[model samples]
Target: MKITKQNIRTALWVTLSVLLVTLLLQNSANVNLRFLHLRAQMPLFAVIMLSALFGAGILWFARRRR
Candidate 1:
């Protein structure tokens, strides 16, 4: 299987979209998971944007190396 530019773009968009939706749903529903005595709360939009930015940064770094 050959990886093309279009494929990469499509994958990136799909991943971002899914992440955004998940984050929004989780935030709106007040979803929370606690382990031990630690607790965390994040806004849906913030989480989604941060994750997407992180992913894009990593991808950019990888592409730059090649």
Candidate 2:
């Protein structure tokens, strides 16, 4: 099959997804998380994923067209 931009993106996404899954599976220990005034216990993977989601959301909001 001929290579295209969409195919490249798909491959990258799949690779990232696999890597993320592996990381999450390997790290599941609970840790104390402090957010502003609230403190709570959260899984290590959950904390990382939440931070990633927040970062992605911020980037999308900033880059989206008005």
Candidate 3:
């Protein structure tokens, strides 16, 4: 198989996903989030996943159109 950018990206994503899953499974505690009086209790994994998704969304939107 020829090495390409797509393959590299796929490999990286897969590795990151596996690592994230392992981390999530190990951390299952409730976390408190208080932002300027707005408070919430959420699973550590959920918060991490949501933050990652939010960052990805921002990057996706910020990418220059070609």
Candidate 4:
């Protein structure tokens, strides 16, 4: 199989989507997040997705500045 930039990007996106779906389906329990003096309760999937998005955003921002 030939590997190209588009192919690599597509593969990564498909892999991430599969992982996200698997995690969402397997995690159904509610989770509590404590940050310093703050607290919040949300579904495990939501928390995971939010954290992933936050991390991605930080990476994108850092990359853009370089």
lDDT of 4 by residue, 1-66 (tens): 999999999999999999999998898799999999999999999998888899999999999999
- The TM-score values for the models, in the order shown, are 0.44, 0.85, 0.86, 0.85
Give the runs in model 2 whose Cα sits over 4 Å from its true position: none
lDDT of 3 at 37: 86
lDDT score of model 3? Answer: 0.92
lDDT for each residue of candidate 1 in 1-66, tens digit (9 for 90 to 100): 689999999999899788777766666533354569987775656656676789889999999999
User: In every candidate, how many clashes are there?
Assistant: 0, 0, 0, 0
Model 2 lDDT, residue 13, Cα: 86
Best by lDDT: 4
User: Which consecutive 10 residues in model 3 have the weakest lDDT in total?
Assistant: 57-66
Those runs of model 4 whose alpha carbons end farther than 4 Å from true positions after fitting are none
lDDT assessment of candidate 2: 0.91
Rank ordering of all candidates by lDDT, starting from the highest: 4, 3, 2, 1
What is the TM-score (0 to 1) of candidate 4?
0.85
Expressed as tens digits, the lDDT of each residue in 2-65 for candidate 2 is 9999999999989988998899899999999787999999899998888878988998998995
Q: Tell how far residue 56 is off in model 4, in angstroms.
A: 0.6
TM-score of candidate 1 versus the correct structure, residues matched by position: 0.44
- Residue 40 CA error for candidate 3 (Å)? 0.9
lDDT of 3 by residue, 34-63 (tens): 899899999999998889889988888889
Model 1, CA-based lDDT: 0.75
